[model samples]
Target chain A: MKKRLYIVLFGLAVLIPLGLLSGSPAWGEWDGAYYKKILGFIPKGIQNAKSLNAPLSDYTLGGTNSITGYYLSAFVGIAILFVLFFVLMKIFKARGKSEQSA
Target chain B: MHIPDGYLSPATVVATYAVVAPLWVYGFKKLKASLDEETLPLIGALSAMSFVIMMFNIPIPGGTSGHAVGAALISILFNPWIGFISVSLVLLIQAVVFGDGGISTLAANALSMAFVGSFVGYYSFMMCKKYRAAPFFAGWIALVSSSVLTSIFLGIQPIFWTLDGKPLYFPFGLKVTFVALVGSHMLFFGVVEGIFTALVYSFIKKRQKVVVA
Candidate 1:
């Protein structure tokens, strides 16, 4: 099962660049300009909504190299998720040991 | 569907977080219970797969494109709560680091894409387990269910939160939002999700003896 899972993950990771083929945005998840053009005005809340400056916003880094940035982003995301899960597993294990001793 | 920041009202944000908080807690407990040495790599890999799958935005005929959330594949393999928690983690990363989704709309997005998608997929797969196409249908049903919830969340904004005839948040009514979001998912993304799930599930099942935990 583990081997199979890795195979699938590696296969998908190799094909991750194919994700960038679509320049079109999903329906309703459009820019504020879209609302201005369609409804004649951007919704007040949407226009004024607070957005944090994400480090890797839109999966692009500082450089114009989007393909490399995308690959890097995928690697970063997977690493972070694994680190978090492992950390949680450690905490749970510590708790279980403490409970057994108690 | 990831609802960006400012697409929902403040009241909606608060309400969604309030609803999601307890479920998150419960889901985490479920995740911990399932997490062991044997399952760690599998869960992590599957979650990573879910994240990578969403990055694939396939273009359809209508000048709009969307990707399949791999919630059903996880839910059918493990369970719904596991699926929910894993995808929620994926959404958090997308929101905070990638900015693909908005922080304010995390709960709403999780509820729609993670919770609804998982349960709908799990039940659908179980109901049709006798058939070879169960995984395909599970993925299809999950995505459609997620689109419906997203439509409801977005559609209600215009109905209740308009000021001086202008919607304070999302501007479309249920009719338009449902027709566009749900209709698109059914026509384009749903099939893609179904095929992906079916293909992956079959590939993995063919090779290994999966002992469902």
Candidate 2:
């Protein structure tokens, strides 16, 4: 609602779509570069400490990597929507009850 | 479970945050309005319980042994935002400290397990609890539904993202094998999740009655 916040959000909205447009066309040519850096950013050496145990290797089933991470993210979004609605309805019902009691 | 980097597609990563961020913001407001002082502690304790539960991992049928994410149960006790932040933090710890899931896939994992898993399981638990006094059905349904949904989420992981060389052509292909994989685990882990959730819920409910008196 504030001016600066709106400006930042406006910039993100414009940039995200532009990115999607560009990325979609060059999907094949994107050359999996980000994934490597992602793999590197994994704090692996920290594993030696007792605080760390799990390993962060790229998933390789059927002798190759999979591409289904995006779908999972989308599904989570749907679940969040459902929660928002369910809680809102419950609150309205409770408010109605309290008003009636008063 | 935190997904490591490169596991999810860019679309999945960005899209998930887009969806969950709004829901979380909304839930934060709703939770503050609904939960009172006594109820708040129960929610916080349940989250801690969810955190501690993950440490007890069973050896999965496959080579890896994975602990249950406990998102479903958390949602049942508190709300979605609590489940979201709690599990996201769990996934973060798994990624940053433990290196269980890739950094890229971490967001996706949080969304799927916490966002998806929590709501699906919580709603199922509520429905069952409404129709039946027995916590068994509530727990069972919560566990089963979350398992199935999460498996579907996992199955689609290959469809959205691209990681070179490792092309996943699952013979099961999110249909048959995935159902079997997700379903079989629900037999045990689902029940475990449900039982754990129900037990905690019952305990808290009793504790609340005592404190209110």
The predictions' CA RMSDs to the true structure, in order, are: 2.0, 16.3
Query: How well does candidate 2 score on lDDT at residue B140?
Result: 55
DockQ of each: 0.86, 0.05
For model 2, residues B164-187, the per-residue Cα lDDT tens digits are 533231111367535554565566
Question: Per-residue CA lDDT of candidate 2, range A34-73, in tens?
Answer: 3335343322212212323333221112333233322222
Identify the runs in model 1 with alpha carbons over 4 angstroms from their true place: B209-213
Best candidate, lDDT-wise?
Answer: 1
Residue B9 accuracy (lDDT) in model 1:
91
